[model samples]
Target: MTIDHFFQAAKIEGFQSPYDTIHLKIFYPARMPSQVEINREILPVDLEKAPFPVVIFFNGFNCDAQQYQWLAVKLAEHGLVVILFNWIAEVMPGIISLTPGIDVEKRKPTIYRTVPTASALPALLAKVEQLQSEGILAGMLDLQRIILGGHSAGGRVAIENADPDFFPQIAASFGYGLHTMATLSLGYEADTILPLPDSLPLLLMGGTCDGIIANSCDRYGISPGNATTPVIRTFQEAITGGRNDSYLLLLEGANHFSINQPDSTLKTPLLDFPATQPQESFRLLMGEIINLFIDTHVRHQPEASQSLEQLLNTPNPLIKSFERK
Candidate 1:
C-alpha cells in the first residue's frame, strides 16, 4: 500500500502526497528574532526554562510532514516540542520522499505481533539529542513527558507502538482518523481488534462523515460504507480501561481529512458528507481539544479533566459525541 501511494505521487507534482516532505521537523517555543513569528525563527534554545513536554507526530499514508506544520506550530506555541516525521522506506532502488526510511514494507511483526514502527523512535530521539548537543533545544525537552500521535495510518503506527512499559518515557498516545483494524492481508478477523499497550492513556478522534475510511474499503474488496464508524469501535474495543483514562471524540460533519486540508488531489471524498464547518475552524477546535488531552495525560493536570468533562457532557454542535473511560 505504501508503494502504491508512492507510484501515484510520482506521476504528478501534486499527486497523492508528494513534495516538501521532510524526514524530520522539530518545533519548539523559543524567543523569535526582532519581528519574525514563532515558526519563522528556530534558534536560541530556551535552556533556562523548565523541561518542555515532547510530542512526536507520524504522518498518514503518503501524507507529508509539511502540511501539518500548522499543527506543529499550534502545539509548540503552547510550550511543547513537536516532532513531525514519516516512515520512509527504501521500497525501490531510488525512490525517496517524506518516508522516515524505516522499511515498514516487510510488515513483519515483532514480539506479540506489533509492527516495526517502534524502530522510528530511536532515530527521532537521536535527532533530539543532536539538537541539544548543538544547544538548539538543549535542556528544553523532557523525554519522560513524551506523547506519540499521528493521523490515519500514521496514528495506527503510534497507538500500536506506544508501549509505556517498554518505553517508559512515553506519557500517552493519540490519533486523528486512526484505527487498528487490519486489512484482509493482515489477517483481520471478525470482532478482533489490535491490542493497545498496557495501561496506556489514549485519545481517539473520529468524524461522523469520514468518507475516506468508508470509500477506501473497496481496496480490501469490502463494501464502501462499512467503516464509517470504525474509530468509535476501535476506541471501545482497544482501550484497556484501568490506571489510565481514555477518550473518544467524534466531530459532527467531519471527514477523514478534517485535521488538515486535503493535501493531495488523490483524496477521493466520494463517500464523505459535505463539511459543515470550515477546515480552519475544525483545526482550531482540534488544537484546543488536544491541549486538554495532553494537559490531562502528559502534564498531569487534574483540572484539565473539568474542561474535557464540559465538552463531553454538555451538548455541542462541533462534537457529535464524546465519551470517557
Candidate 2:
C-alpha cells in the first residue's frame, strides 16, 4: 500500500468473441520510457511490481469505462492491475449504454439498448490472455489473485457471475451501490429483499442520499429509500460462506455515482441526481476501505484482518453505517 508507482493506461484492440471484439483499456503501474509508443506517450509497464493482482471492472448503465478511471488509477497506483472494456448502448452510444444482468426480467437477463452482448467473465478472461500475448502486460498479471467488481447495475453483473466453480481464479467480488435483493421483474414478489451471493466474498455499499435506487423502483420494483436498508439487510441475513467474508457499508453524504469522478457534469450523469459530498473526498475514503478488502480477502494478508475490523468499527466522518455477517 504505497502510491509510489506512477500508473498509465494502454488500449488493445481485438479479442474476438461471438458477441463483439472485446477491447480493453488497462490501467497499470508504469515507468516513463525514453522511447514511448508513437503518437501517444505510452510508458512501459513497471516490471518492479510484476505479477500484480487484477481487477476486472464493469461500469454502471449508460456509463463508459472512462468514468471509472479515477477508481482504476487509484487502485493501479497501489500496484494493482485494472481492466475496463469498450461498451456501447448500440442505439445511442453514450445516452443509454447497456450492460448484461443490469436488466434481468423473470430472473432471466435481457439485452437492453440492443447491444445483444453479455459481460460475462469468459469474455474478459479471454482478453486478459490476449493482453499477455501482445506484450503490454506480459508475464506481469497474477491470475491467482483477481477480483471482479463493478458499480450500480454493473455491480449486479459482478455479483451474479462470481461462481467459484466456474471462475476459480477470482478471489473476491465487490460492488458499490449493489445488492442481491430479488426484484418484481425477476419473478419475486416485489422487494422480496434478501437473496445473497454464496460463492464469493462480497462488499456491498450504498449512500444515504442515493437517489438512484429510488428512481430504480419503476424498472426493478425494489424498496425505495430508507423504508428498509436493503443493502445492509442483505449482508446481515446472508448464510454461511458469503456471510463470513462479506461487509456492508453506507456512506454518510455520498451518492450512487460517488465512485465516479466529479470531473465534469458531462462525464458524470444527471441520472445520479447530484452527489452530496465531493467525489474525491468520498473516493479517498472509498479507496482505502476497498484496498483493505482486496488486501485481506483477495491477497489473504493476515495482518490486514485486524486493521479492517478496527477501521470499520471506529468513528469516522465518511462512514455512516457498517455491518459484517
Candidate 3:
C-alpha cells in the first residue's frame, strides 16, 4: 500500500501523526563514576500527565541515541514515554582499521570487536531507577509496565543482560565476532539470566535479514533466519517456562534497518534491500502494533488486545504478528 494509505489506516486505529514536541534530554547522575556514567534521553508525550508507560530502547552498534527518535516520538504520541541510550561510545576507537566500509554511526562498528554488554547493563538499570526516584517518570511512568528492546548487537546485549545463560551456549558454539564476541570469549562474569523482573516486561525485535554475525543454520552463520530463531526460542522458553508475561513480533521481510528511522545516515556492508514495504507504511503499522501491545499488556486495556488481534489477523502482505505461548 502507498504511504498515504498507511497513514490513513494508522489514524483510523488512533495512531497519532508524528509530533516533534518530543524532546530528548540527557541526564547525568553524580553518584556514578565517569566511565559508568549514563547517557539517557527522555522523550515525553505531549499530554500533561503524571505517569506514563516507559520503554527503554538500547540501540544497535554504530547507532546513537537519536536513531530511534522517530519511533520514540510516535510511541510517545500514543501516551508512552520512550527512552533511548548511547550506552557505548558512538565510534569504536580502532575497529575502523580492522573492518573497512562498515558504517561507524549506524551499524556500531566497534560493537563487533568488543563485548560491552555486561558493562552497559548496570548503567541502564540505574537510569531506570533514577527516573523512578526523581519522579521524572513519576505518575506517568508505570514501573509495573516496562518494555526493553534493541536492534542487532544491541539485541544481543539486551538478551545477555536479561539472561546471562543466554549466550554462553551460543558463544561456545561460535567464538566472538568483533566486539561482543571478543568480550564473551574472554570469559567475563555476568548476572544470571533470571526471568525478567516482575517490574519489567520484555519485547524483542530483530531483522529477519541480518547476516553480519553468522552461525549454524546459514553458511555465514550470521543469517537472519538463524539468528532470530534461536533468540526468539530462548525468549519464549524463558517466558513460557516461567509463565511470565511477554510478547514477540517478527517482521517477515524486514531487515536490521527496518526498526530504525529510514532517514538514518549510517550504511553497512550488508546488502541494502529494496523497499518492498513503503517506509511510511512500515513505520505507521509498527507504531500502531506497538501501541496495541503496550495498551493491552502494560495498561490492562482489554479492548486494545482485541483490536490488535484483528490487526494481526488482517492478512496484509505488508505486516504480520504473533503472540508467545
The C-alpha local distance difference test score for the whole of candidate 3 amounts to 0.45
Candidate 1, lDDT over the whole model: 0.67
Question: Which stretches of model 1 miss by more than 4 angstroms?
Answer: 1-22, 33-41, 46-49, 86-115, 218-223, 267-273
Compared with the true structure, what per-residue lDDT tens digits does model 3 show for residues 116-230?
2334344444555566676434444556455544565555444444432322211101001111222222232331122332223445544344344323233222333353554
Q: Each model's TM-score, in the order given?
A: 0.80, 0.80, 0.59
Off by over 4 Å in 3: 1-49, 88-93, 96-118, 132-140, 159-201, 206-208, 211-245, 263-265, 269-272, 320-323
Give candidate 3's total backbone clashes: 26
Better structure of 2 and 3 per lDDT: 2
Tens-place lDDT digits, model 1, residues 1-325: 0000011011112223443223566777665345453454244444333488888887776577776777888887777878876545533567653443333442433334443455566656666666555555666678678888888877877777778656677888888887766555544444445567747788889887777787766444445684445677687777667664788888887777788656555444444556777778778888888888888877878898788677667877888888777
Clashing pairs in 1: 86-100, 87-100, 88-99, 88-100, 88-101
In the range 114-145, model 2's lDDT, one tens digit per residue, is: 33123345767776676666666777888877
- Superposed Cα deviation of residue 202, candidate 3 (Å): 3.8
Alpha-carbon lDDT, every model: 0.67, 0.67, 0.45
**lDDT (Cα, 0-100) at 278 in candidate 1:** 77
